[model samples]
Target: MLSGKTLVVAAGIFLLGLVSFGEAIMGGSEAAAHSRPYMASIQAVEGDAMKHECGGFAVADQWLMTAVHCLPAGPNGRKVVLGVHSLSQAEDTKQTFDILELHNHPQFNPDNYDNDIALIKLDRPFNSTEAVKAVAFLRAGGVNPDTNAEVETAGWGSLDNLGNRPDALHEASMGVVSSTRCGRSDYFGRKFTGNMICAHKLCPDPCDGPHRIVDSCDGDSGGPLLYNGVAVGITSNGGKKCGQVKKPGIYTIISHYTEWIDGVMGLQPDA
Candidate 1:
């Protein structure tokens, strides 16, 4: 049976005199420009070092969607880097934005990872281009997708549990598993809530050839779980060891919070 452990969310509280958890890039390969244009790299800049904390996505000219745990209330020296493919090199297509406001959900429960979503308002609007684009949300009241549907997860975290962070963005294919399966005795069990989703990594047949044991870990928090170009989930928590068999990565389901998100973004509830 699984122990009741509060699996650490990717980025620790940085702006509040807290420690920053160095985590990310587990089980994904380099991503291309067109693959995930809405992707945003959230960072904390301190003097000479700029650290990648979490991943987010633009939903509007001045609004972004991310995990509440990524940002603790109060001020922080954080920014969002968009339209870039590499973290080490600055490309002409890249643009940076200063975070003017962080609107974490009012009812967010950190103890159980409930309402693990938040929105970021940019100091200025992003000039949309081919490299930088806003993504559509998972429409409200949509039918629950099939458990077998492929979910594409992207981030700049680590490649393994205790590995080094990747210099480039990486993406991987995973499959949505039944919450019942994910909540089995061996998994999170009753700790899994309705707001959470579970995705299992796909391991290739080593006997045949190349196959990645794709699963989110370390620094993938706040990243998106995209389905048909819509972000349906956000990376939340997972097992202690990423990519472990039967230890699926959990995400915050977006559909359940569309009304809350709409309210925060000042859009119609049904919009």
Candidate 2:
């Protein structure tokens, strides 16, 4: 498939969601530490770097994980800058590392977005911080997360659909939806095989936040999903509009891709 040079949403039974035919991404949470999603920066780019591309998280001391679509290639020498409060420039004290290699799931199908996950291996280990820490990556093992469970999403996308991708990270809260309401039919593949999950507010008219924090939109793809401080999923793709009741937000189930991530990283995803 031709790279659209960009990507990342929604769906309906409830009239709010994470449906694929709609967009299906997920997010991670960190608290006042996570009022919004923060970004990692590249120390210095040769040229055309301002294009800077999509934002990702440091899942490991040396590794930065992001959506496969954001980086079609370039595992070697790729820079993973952490604790960046903004995108303006690189500074000291922010943990930095070099990308020694990259591992994007081999079956990744940009069209259907199957196996939509990637792992970045850093050249060396860096320090961790409360503002920026390693999120727990779970095995999922195809187990359904309990409904009404609180989940959080973090990204650098537009607070609103009509805006630009924020230079810094932003966050929002959602609840895991019951599989029954997601329109499961024999035709939709095995219940959890689609490798996607839905999480949202029980009611979606949407609540206002103090800093005025909003949700995932264009440019928020490949962000993290946090449940009780564990990183469980990544932003896959959601539809165009957001913060509505009818459109359910979809996420690439992280637990479902343990083997692939581990294989690429040369470490066991479950270990």
Candidate 3:
């Protein structure tokens, strides 16, 4: 049931491609991709227990935002792990956190991926002392308003572009692109909208697709789009495949729902 609008959004993303706006996938620098501090160990909907879908932090101790696609259908899904950077030791006793509650857009269209973002309330506030620290959010109107910014994104999802799991976390850096130009791509023309952000390809763009970044793929959805030390967006959807130069990775624009996020999550608006 891909609505025409959803298809248009997908087409928009396919044309724009994943670009690093204002920063890289690992924070602000390319070297920061594999770096800790900004990373989080998310475990969502693993069978009956909390499944370990990939997600990361935005505020220092409050919210853990993610892609709605990570949520398991129905009430059977669960969440685990909270503040940890190393997957090798993420399962260690002290680093894990149980599920609190899950919040996804009520009108999410699975086919169209509208409202693709979600929040995982933590059972307990994140500890001040941990290898994984929450990322910062761009002040209400402080950053990329429409499209195109230098930024970074990171995740520990399955490395293989085609698979749905990953052995550990990996990071990548790239730049953002204009939404207007995004629609001109062979795949995603005029699909860009106010809620979606695009990342263009790099010199050695690995794979080739309108909706994917060769450096990052599946399992990384819901991760952060950090620009200048702020978590400004969340990974949304990729085109049909990974690494098509014609395609780029699209993300949920964090600013679009400012009031809804503050209102629903009960957080103060950014000054």
Candidate 4:
């Protein structure tokens, strides 16, 4: 139920004169090195260089999750870089892997951005290390966080409206916004779906207040939204400009897709 207005994809390449709907981290601080072991950087091979495209996180030994929009053309030139805190440094803990397969949600709708989740299979299982590991995720029938619950997200996306990206990963704390509130006419309205979750720092009036807002912006697509040490959502989309009041970053609820994820990963369902 996206607005009739044309929408541009975020966290990746953008065409001129298009407003981006996806987002990255704004008003966040640099994350401690190797603190977020599950974080993954989805990079695209641009000629001889591998450029950062989106954020993702490991869910299992060889599987990571991201937004389907992050790999619109499939995984032809995509690679997953794990255990990387700084993109500029040659970290000894970095693990790079070729994408073995990509499993996008069968019912994904690009127009409305619904069911935006996708899983990437690595060519080989990850080697356990201090800076490389998988994180826990929400299971089917698990309790979802309540409104105002504190959650966190991290990425290497632009830090502000001018598109200032960072070499090191950054993280921010935000509060969950109820679907009812997020779906208000002034907010996302019909574009916000049940399968989606939203989070942001509270700002009564962005235009009038001096408060610094924290949110995901361009280049943060496909990242994890962690709550209570578990990944409950996947970064999907947001306002044209990040950190806007009443325009929280939208995410694909992981609990809603556990069955599909289990089937694709060949894991037994939780009893």
lDDT by residue for model 2 (178-256), tens: 6555535532234333677766663313442212223356666777777776777777654457544444566678888
TM-score of 4: 0.87
Measured by TM-score, the strongest candidate is: 4
lDDT of 2 at 7: 23
Local distance difference test values of all predictions, in order: 0.78, 0.59, 0.61, 0.87
What's the ranking of the predictions by TM-score, best on top?
4, 1, 3, 2
Tell me the spans in candidate 3 whose CA falls farther than 4 Å from its real position. 1-34, 44-51, 58-60, 72-75, 90-94, 145-148, 162-166, 205-215
Q: What ranges in model 4 sit over 4 Å off?
A: 1-26, 203-209
Residue 64, model 2: lDDT of 68
What TM value does model 2 have?
A: 0.70
Runs with alpha carbons beyond 4 Å of true place in candidate 2: 1-52, 73-78, 89-92, 140-144, 184-193, 202-206, 209-214, 268-271
Candidates 1 and 3 compared: the better one by TM-score is: 1
Candidate 1: clashing pairs of residues: 23-219, 24-157, 24-158, 24-218, 24-219, 25-157, 25-158
Q: After superposition, which runs of candidate 1 have C-alpha atoms over 4 Å from their true positions? A: 1-27, 206-212
Candidate 1 weakest lDDT stretch, 10 residues: 15-24
- Model 1 over residues 1-271: C-alpha lDDT tens digits? 4334422332223322121111222346688754688889999886797788899989899998999888866438888989967887868988899999898988888776788999999999999889899998786787545787888888887776565788888888778998888888888887788988888655553212233456787777888898876889999888777766667788999889877887787887542
Give lDDT tens digits, candidate 3, residues 27-47: 211233235455655664554
Residue 259 C-alpha lDDT in model 1: 76
TM-scores for every predicted model? 0.85, 0.70, 0.73, 0.87
